[model samples]
Target chain A: MTPSAEDAAAGLQYSRVLDAPPELVFDCFTQPGHLTHFWAPKGASAPTTEILVDLRPGGRFETLIVNDATGATYATRSVFLEVHAPDILAWHEEHTGMTVRVTFTALPGGRTLFSLHQSDIPDQVLRPENRAGFATTLDKLSNYLHHLADGAKQ
Target chain B: MESMLKNRPPGSLDAAFAALADPTRRAILTILADGDATVSDLAAPFAMSLPAVSKHLKVLEASGLISRTRNAQFRPCHLERAALDGVGDWIEDHRRVWDERLDKLDQHLAELQGGKEERDDS
Candidate 1:
């Protein structure tokens, strides 16, 4: 189930289907090493230089993004609001007074429904650029996982 | 711990994130994000005095969100988006993994239940 509407008004809600198990998807997120690979998709403008996430309510969620050619970091921080294993994660974003909630659901047919809903955000994150950026990242994840799944077959 | 982006480069992620955790400090960053700002310019909006704004500036400085200048002691604050890249990148990573595992679980459940339904038909 999702949070109340009052809660969502503060953020953006997003969900996507993945052809994998919840456990695997959860592992992909919880495992820092794995995260570095697919954080940003190929041909995307931004690059993920670092990702450090502690698996706890008060634990840190830190990462770094850099320009690919210049290697200049664009942003970084460790924000923590709440975390429920394999289900939800809530955190504040870059002093924007907004919060991010990432939800995961296990659907039938070996598919996982993952959604990211950010609340309390304004036009900044709502801009088309931000959404497109995230969509690109998701596309990378799908492609990478598809490759991994294929490898398992071989 | 409270200092404007003086003498320090917006060099690392940890320091940057620590500085951004506060609303006041984040406000300072937002202002800096717009452009450069003097102590007075940054403090103009808040009800607080210049000293209060300076205090926030100190923290921002430590976090690499802003930097001071040598001229006239008017340390201007600047917004540095470089340090914030990690947040979005990390979230994207988590989303990817969550997708993978959730899909796997669904398939497993369907497999178990699918066999039961098939046997029931027989």
Candidate 2:
């Protein structure tokens, strides 16, 4: 479904200091080759899936995460509305979707401050604790990305 | 958010998640989980008054994390462990989902590394 990625949803911040430079860290996020390393964790078999990305303003992006074992897929596709190099990349994930704004600012000693701030969703309904789940999921992503940067050096 | 999770054990998932989300609620649950407690017993740890404790209890009760029972004029609050099974179940599912993603990443990285080494050798 085409969900609108709006900024109005309560925002979330997930930050980590990647061992790589800002450009390198940014590349992994924007490039498919690098994305497959840190986007989602390992073990999900989505062999019947495709990922596409055009890292530019007004670019189209699409990806399908399918689990063949379970015959499930969470397909999300959107357009890249803006890109500010290694500093920022903004895109509309899918209405009722998530708009992710990832920022990479250089840190001292060649490290990069990686932050993925996503916003746009109404109150936490049903199971209200999803608010905390968001934080944990982001934390996992931060660690996953951190290890990716570390592994690159070894 | 986790609210999307359906087909979970009764009030179990919601109780655990909602309880941990707030410090006051978490402390309250922890107190009850250790043993059944009266309203005054629940109120002792907090700086807040009985009414505040009542409000927190209302939230917990609505979530089915705790049950308030009558004993003479005093109502004792008791923990419902069955209502918290969702916590463990939800967490495990979440773990499995992420673990799957991580596995794919490992394979992708190895392939990238292999390709790079071949290029370097050439």
TM-score of chain B of each: 0.61, 0.70
**Candidate 2 ranges with C-alpha deviation above 4 Å:** A1-17, A44-49, A54-61, A66-107, A112-154, B1-19, B62-64, B67-73, B80-83, B95-122
Instruction: Compose the digit string of candidate 1's lDDT tens values, residues A1-154.
Output: 1122122222223466655566766766666665554443332222333577777766776666555666666454557666666776667666454456666788997667777654443333312344444433334433433332222221
**Cα-based lDDT for every prediction:** 0.52, 0.54
Tell me the deviation in Å of residue A5 in model 2: 23
- Estimate, for each residue in A23-66, the C-alpha lDDT of model 2 and write its tens digit: 76667667766665555534343222376888888787776665
Error of 1 at A4 (Å): 4.6
Give me the runs in candidate 1 sitting further than 4 Å from their true place. Answer: A1-6, A41-49, A122-154, B1-122
DockQ of 1: 0.02
- Output the worst ten-in-a-row residue range by lDDT, candidate 2 chain B: B1-10
Cα lDDT, model 1, residue B109 = 45
lDDT of 1 by residue, B1-122 (tens): 11121222333333343344445665565566567889899888888799888877876676554667867577566654443333334434544644554444444444544544322210
